[model samples]
Target: MNETLSLFGLATTPLELLSFVLSVVTVWLNIRQNHWAWLFAILSSGLYGGVFFDAKLYGDMGLQLVFITVSVWGWYQWLHGDDTHERLPVTQLTARGRAVAALAWLGAFAVLAWFLRSFTDTDVPYADGFLTAGSLVGQVLLSRKRLENWHVWIAVDVLYVGLYLHKGLLLTAVLYAMFVVMAAIGLRAWRRSMGQHGQASATMVLK
Candidate 1:
């Protein structure tokens, strides 16, 4: 029997099962606009870092470190990173912000892919780099409470599901599949919030 498949009733690695639970909780909390999710994010990232390291997915392993930092930054952002020291509202990316995010994603992909290609013997460097880069963009957007973050997550998590499957991380693949669904749900919920806010602003203007 595979030890990795000996954990929960679902039969996954201990780290995988734990990370899966933490990540799911993190996403669900985020969907409800809760800041506590970041704490879980940090823990999940740490566990996944070890899992990816053992799996020889060096790029993803490095990404887990980045995720730890991003989770910390996000925690602060949700609590007091607002310009007015108040809770930040769901917002849209500015046109310039969109451009910058695009450039950042491209640059991250190029640099990480090159580094993985030159320094690591990992076979999925490009795929790993691509997903890692996308995660960076998604994490930043999420930290800022940008509504579009869910879209980024949906796109990347789908690819992640496939990649984890290819890498034989069955549990991680299942988690990413659920991430895709959660991202979609988050997008819809956030869109409703945006609409409600818009209506409120228009009503205020009329009054």
Candidate 2:
């Protein structure tokens, strides 16, 4: 056990430490509804992208590249997507939207799993595909200011904690543990903001 732990530590090294720190900052910025959160997220994702490649988590490594592009889109959306120059409003997904998102998740998972199983020696192809697909959905929803994004994040992040631990990546496991807590906080905060926005919209309608 000790030897396994030491091996994981060697994999982490100093760059992973920097990635961990940046990830924390990214989550903090996200909680504050800052557009710059995406910038930090991009940096953190870029660092971890390489780390996952080394760890043979090919799906996650590829997801980080997608995250970079999404981060740019997110930054733009948060800044200019709203009409009043305000930060993007937190809103829940509609029923139709939820249905569509579910379909996307399923499709992505199936395709990714097949590709990974065929092309890579990944040990847990389905698990990796599922988490990666779910995370992609969460990131897209988050970029669009969807309140339900945190729920998806909380679920997948919990799974990731166990997955990383099983893979013997202790530090990455710890990072996901922190992500779980942050996701909870983000859910509460976004829900509160959504309530406030709803009330304000109601007031405007009355006027």
Candidate 3:
């Protein structure tokens, strides 16, 4: 089979096409709060691992491995992290929590950027490391049911779109572009969930 085909003047490969479809489904499921999203996340991350590797985006390749680990943890947490087997509910982080998460992302970017620059031949080390660190922080927030995760994803996806375009991964660039839109939708949906839950809890207290 041909590895690359011209799709509206972009490189579209079978593998990238598969990854794109799975990634879209995964995010849509995530917005709907379906644990099945984690399963698809695992699959998409595995495929993206190869996709990024072929593009010499080593940081992203490593990030995919981390994503798989996080997805498994997220799968279990979403299924059983509540009082029993109930699904996890979205909640906002405190100001301090947000600060701490931001600190962690900055710290990770510094470390990973140094490592990639010192040891790897990656061209866009800073951008790659920045996105990788942002993704790590976002995944951690997401697994813990934080509403701020979508914000992190929205930011990361924008950078990723540009980085992939620079690296000549047109399909992956398009994928991240879609991710940015979906992350915005997810932010709106999760905020709605949190608002409704808070109202319900208040009513229970009144009762």
Models ranked on lDDT: 3, 2, 1
TM-score of 2: 0.92
Per-residue accuracy of model 1 over 1-207 as CA lDDT, tens digit each: 125565344557777778888989999999988999999899989988888987789988998898899889889888887789887778898999888988999999999999999999898989999989989999999999999899899999999989998888888888999999999999999888888878987999999
Candidate 1: stretches off by over 4 Å:
6-11, 201-207
RMSD of each: 2.2, 3.3, 1.4
Best-performing candidate as measured by lDDT? 3
**1-207, model 2: which lDDT tens digit per residue?**
112223344445566677788999999899889888998999999999977887789999999999999999999999877887776899889999999999999999999999999999989889899999999999999999998899889999999998898776778889899999999999999899889999999999999
- Check candidate 2 and list the clashing pairs: none
What is the clash count of model 3?
A: 0
Q: Please, what is the whole-model Cα lDDT of each candidate in the order they appear?
A: 0.88, 0.89, 0.92
lDDT of model 2 at position 46: 94
lDDT, model 3, position 33: 92
**lDDT: worst 10-residue window of model 3:** 1-10
Residue range 114-173, candidate 3, lDDT tens digits: 999999999989998999999999999999889999999999999888888888889889
Q: In model 3, where do residues sit more than 4 Å from their true spots? A: 83-85
